[model samples]
Target chain A: MELICPAGTPAALRSAIEAGADAVYCGFNDETNARNFPGLNFSRDELRKGIAFAHDRGARILVAINTFPRASATALWQRAVDDAVEAGADALIVADIGLMDYVARRHPNQRLHVSVQAAAANPDVIAFYVETFRARRVVLPRVLSVVEIAEIIRETTCETEVFVFGGLCVMAEGRCSLSSYATGKSPNMQGVCSPASHVAYEETAQGTTSRLGGFTINRFAPQEAAGYPTLCKGRFSTALGDGYIFEDPVSLDATTLLRGLQSAGVAALKIEGRQRGRAYIESVVRHFRRALDTLEDGSEADIVSLKPFTEGQASTLGAYRKTWR
Target chain B: MSHSSVASRPLPTIPPLLTLAIRPLPLLPLQLVLGGFLQRILRRNPGLLDRLGEHRYARFGIKPVDLPFAFIVEAAPPRLLVVRELPQGLDARVSTSLANLLALVEGRVDGDALMFSRQLGIEGNMEAVLALRNAIDDAGLDLPGELASLFGPLGEPARRSFELARDRLTGPPEEER
Candidate 1:
């Protein structure tokens, strides 16, 4: 399988390209892109430059115009698609049916992929995007197991990609409204999740507890590891008692499952940290590239070596093995 | 909208005392706390955070922003900062209102309230946010001592939680020798 990577900005794009990513996906710094946090993404001109940068290096750039267009502001999204085509984007990753309709009709030449945020878990939905938008690929949600992924692959001809090393979402992608529930903003509409704006950390006499908005998400002692404040995974209390009702603070690591993913007919493996630095990108891209190479020879990869690159210095095979109780 | 996003503060000079005092207060880690602070700052300052392009924090080792779009910071001293080089022609100055920003950094605000409201801005390229983030992470954030909201009844339920945190933690205060 090829390696698909995330480039939150032009710098990240170049970093990924230089680090050995077969292809890099990024979004404009607007609602059009799904990772719509404050300090991530590129502008139109930057996209042009980024595309040229990738092409010049024999790499590919996939522009993510994935957000659903609002009825009141359809023109803005239309302009984004226009700009992407004008900039010579290699592919357009989209989720909304309306936006996909616009792109497929307006720029039939543009390659289209389904954004995982759409949460199209079943073959019927995945095939729906492929048939409806002529999507060439579909980024599968994290909820599916390896067996499930193989089943989907068997049922469709669409090229499939799975998140190999990076953050993991326990909930179905695109279907989550947790961030919106916590902060009026959500990944679907606002392009932010557990938005940085709502996160808080306080230090007092006892220990450190991470809070999102005013809600206590997780509390940890000084010696314990700390992860970024993704609200869904936070440890908390409710009328039902205290637990990570959503998830724990563990990242998804599919390094050990690379051979299986490739055999299951996945066309690409993705690493998901556009918010990370170049150093992190370079290390992850290089390690995965090497692992995939090792698999070409049917040998077990040194998957443990990529530990430092994992978010929070930890990683797991996630649902691939169903180890969680 | 974060204070430091627009505030012209110097390099880090955390006294270690601040972090130590935070332990017993039933607070979260700094990573989680910083987001609410940044959001609150954005709300009060409005476009001031984008104004960093026009104004440079020389003390913080940041480059002087000369972006086409300029943002202002209605900070403590009221400065006109610019977010130079961006293609957007949006010009914003800091709103000079910071009750919310200060409150967030102080751990007085709630997470649910932040998402459920319209308090931040997205006037320019979102990609620049990362560079802006780099600047923030690079900046030496010395959180102000506006932590009055941490006491009282809401503070009682977490006493055991606090004890667990305190007992489990090791090492002396960050600043103490």
Candidate 2:
């Protein structure tokens, strides 16, 4: 199986490749991609250079143009598709159906992989994307069990990819609006969820409270590990109790399930975090590469502990386990 | 020390005698030297502060727990002040070892990983801290190289000395060891 990694910058792209990434995915330094954070992503020239660097090393580059375009500003998204293709991206990971249609029609021979933002969970939807857009692969959302993933793979003709490590989004991909409700920016539209510009941390008498757009997301006592102010992973006071209402602060780690995913015929294993630094990219990619290599050698991979890179210093298998529900 | 006290106390990585030796040093001279260095860096990389955006206004307290003094950096109307005690009302404070701080500046160590390992402690505005981290990472500052460039004829020697001192003081990164 392929080990796809993330690159927020040219340096990170180099680090991922050096650490044994079979393919590296990145986006333009704009809203064209999901990780459109300030000081992250690539300029057009950087993307072109990064693709050349990867290609020279026999690794592929996948460009993400996954955000939905505004009706009035469809040209911007269309331009991104054209530029990504012009930059010689191995594949275009797209989410918006309209954008996918544009890519299919405009660049008929270019490889297309449906982004997880599309939330293409089941076989029928995956098949539709394969037939309509001629999408060669579909990144399955983080809301599937190993059994469910196998079922989808069994029925769908397109290749399948699963997120093996990094941030875990509890809400359905491409459909979450909680961030927009609080910050007026959604990942699907603005390519940023709980954007740092709108996030604030305050040291109060109670402890440290993380607030997003004037609303408290989570609070930590002295010395407790703090998490990023993601809306879905925020703590809340429901009628029953004052604690994590939606999901706890944890990162996705499916290292143990590599064998299961491979058995289920996963085409690629993805490491999420294009917003992360090169150190993170290097370490995580190296660790996963070792794990995948060990698995190929027909032995259980002795996965290194990745707690330090995880959110809240905790890792969960996420929805990959049936017991997660 | 208790777990609660970890944030305030110096990490055990530093020799206690080294911290004791640093305690007697006057702050004013260090402050002036660091202030000049900050200006030189800003002049060299003008776009560095721009990456912080509105966060440039925030006061960032950089506490190298192993060191005797801390630095409060203000990106807007730029200032870098060394103080024996961290003043109240700073927008954010990040506590870690001096080695980690230098490594972070060079993008050698990941901030999230440091935080996850409980080696880095951050208080107050996370957004501002994140902005500062991103800005610094994007700038890709090389302190040794910057210091070396300051001296035209003795550039190589200055860089060599600085790197030697850094290696002697901090040793190799934990991963390398």
Candidate 3:
């Protein structure tokens, strides 16, 4: 299976390549990509340079223009597609059907990958994207178990990519509006979830309180580690308890299940953190590459070393071992 | 409004840091030591400055919230100087505890988690701060290791002492080195 990694900048792309990423996925520095964090992502010239650098070193670059284009601003996304194509992106990962259709009609030869934001869980939805947009691959959403994923792979013609490591979204991709309701900026429209501009923190006598758009998300004691105030991972007061009501502040680590995913005919394993720095990209990619090597040699990979790198210093198998559902 | 729709949301109101609540204490000795340490570290690893490229010229003010003084860092020419007061304008200003800052420099703690939890506060230009962070993180940072090297033949003992000090300060059983 191909080990795909995330890169937010040219420097990070280079780091990922050197660290043994088979392919590095990134996006232009704008709302066209979901990780629209301030000061992260690539410029067009940087993308061109990054693609050349990666391709020269026997690696591929996938451009993610994954955010939904506004009805009045379709031209901007179209231009991004055109620019990415011109920049020699190996493939374009897209979520919007209209944009996919545009790619099919205009750049028919361009290899399209369905973005996870599309949330195509079953074979029928995957087949639809494959048939209509000729999507060569579909990045499966984070809601399916290994058996379900295997079934989908068996039933669909498109290649399958699954996120093996990094942040886990509690909601179905492309469907959740909790962030939009709280901050008025949806990942689908603005490519930002729990935007920093809509976040505030106050060190009070009680604790360090984090709030998003005037609503409290989580509070941390002086000794406790605090996570990002992502709406989905926020601790809330419920009838049950004032704890993580949706999901805990944990990351996904599927290193142990790599063999199962490979047996299920998974084409790619993706690490999701384009907003991370080069150090993070390099370390994670190196570990995953080593694990893949060991797996190829029929050896079990020791994933305990990866504990230090996990978000919130915790890891879960996530939906792959789904008891949550 | 639904998930698909976009609307103009009001910007979040950031509560100002209450410097008045902090008891004024002597911190010049700590600031000088930190400033000297930073200068030595930057000198030894010029690559850290190079990684920032043009952004190296951008000025950063490092303010340890627990300390009374701040230090200004210029990565371009790579200079660190202790300041009695913060400059009027800076590309980025990071405010945190002295121990936390040391922990970050040593790569003993997760920088992202600290930022997320609001333990480390950043003010000023976002791009400069991001660039600075990437550069620092990319350098294979180890404050104790780097500082011990300055001691020549006494490096090993110095490193051990620094590690012990850090352990006492941070006070957590780390799972990974």
Candidate 4:
């Protein structure tokens, strides 16, 4: 299987390729991509250079223009598509139907991969994208089990990619509004979920409290490891008790299920973290590369050594296992 | 030679006796030297501080737990000074060992991984700390190379000494492995 890694900057793109990524995915430095964080993403010139660097090493570059664009501001997204194609991006990962239609009509020869932001979980929805826009691949959402993924692959003609590592979104990808409700800025539109500008951490006598948009999201004792202040992973109070109401703060590590996923006909294994630093990109990509190499050699990969990189020092298989439900 | 093996290599730690030996020395000279080093870094990477955005005004306390002193950095206008005690009203403080701090600054170690392992302690404004991390990571600062560039005529010798010290103190260079 192809090992797809994330590159937030030109340095990270080089690091990912050097560490053995078959293909690296990145986005432009604006809301045109999903991970629009400060000091991240690539400029047009940087993307071109990064693509040249990756291609020289026999690696592909996939540009993401995944965020939903406003009807009045289609030009920005359109320009991103045109620029990415011109930059020799191996493929474009797009989510918005309008943008996909534009890419199909404007640059029909360019390969398209349906972004996870589309939440095309079922085979029918996957088929619609593949048949209409000729999407060559579909990034399966984090909501399906290995069996479900196999079934979907069995029914669809498009290649399938599944996230094997990184952050877990509890809500459906394209439908999440929790961040928008907490903060006025919509993650779907603004490409920021619980934006850092609206987040505050206060240390009191009781504990360290993390608040988002003036609303308390979680509190950690002095000895506890703190997590990022996202609404989905927040602790809350209910009449029954007070605890994590939506989801626990943990990263997804589906490394143990590599054989299962391979049997399920997964064409790519993606490691997600475009906002991460080069160290993370290098380490994670190197580990996954070794594992995939071992698997290809007909041996069981020993995949455990990633604990120190997980959020709150904890990881879960997430929806890849039915027990998570 | 794989990157994973290099990343998993054990990190070096400063000897306790060295830190204790420097405890009684005056801090003024050290402070001035650090201030000059900070200026050099800023001059080389002009966009480093600008990437912090609004957090540029915040005061950041960087404490090397093994050392007797800490550094207080005021990002706006870019001032860095060594302090015996962290002052009040600082926006954020990050505490870790000197070796870990060096590794982090050089991007040899992952900050998130360090934090997850409880080796790094952070207090106060998390957002500001995150912004600072992202800014530093984006700059891709090579501390040893930058330090060597500080010397005029003796740059090659200084770089060789720095590399030797790093290899002996830590492990071999990742590329060499």
Off by over 4 Å in 1: A238-241, A298-304, B1-131, B135-177
Q: What is the C-alpha local distance difference test score of each model?
A: 0.62, 0.84, 0.78, 0.85
**Candidate 4 — which pairs collide?**
none
Please tell me how candidate 3 rates in CAPRI terms. incorrect
Tell me the deviation in Å of residue A139 in model 4. Answer: 0.4
> Which runs in model 3 stand beyond 4 Å of their true positions?
A300-304, B1-61, B64-68, B72-81, B84-93, B96-110, B113-177
Over A158-226, each residue of candidate 1 has an lDDT whose tens digit, in order, gives 999889988788877877877788778777765777776676655455555667667788876644555
lDDT-better candidate, 3 vs 4: 4
What 10-residue stretch in candidate 4 chain A is worst by lDDT?
A300-309
Candidate maximizing lDDT: 4
lDDT of 1: 0.62
Candidate with better TM-score, 3 vs 4: 4
TM-score of each: 0.68, 0.89, 0.77, 0.91
Which whole-number lDDT from 0 to 100 does residue A243 have in model 1?
Answer: 77
lDDT per residue as tens, model 3, A1-325: 9999998767678878987999999998789999887656777888999999998999999999999999999998999999999999999999999999999999999999999999999999898999988999999999989999999999888999999999889898988899999989988878988886677666678877778888999987875656767888889988887888888888899988999999999999999888766545766787899999999997766643555456666789999999763
RMSD versus native structure for model 1: 14.6
Residue-level lDDT tens digits of model 2 in A211-280:
8899988888766766667888788988899978888778899999999999999999999988777667
Considering just the first chain, candidate 4 attains a TM-score of 0.98
- Isolated chain A TM-score, each model: 0.95, 0.98, 0.97, 0.98
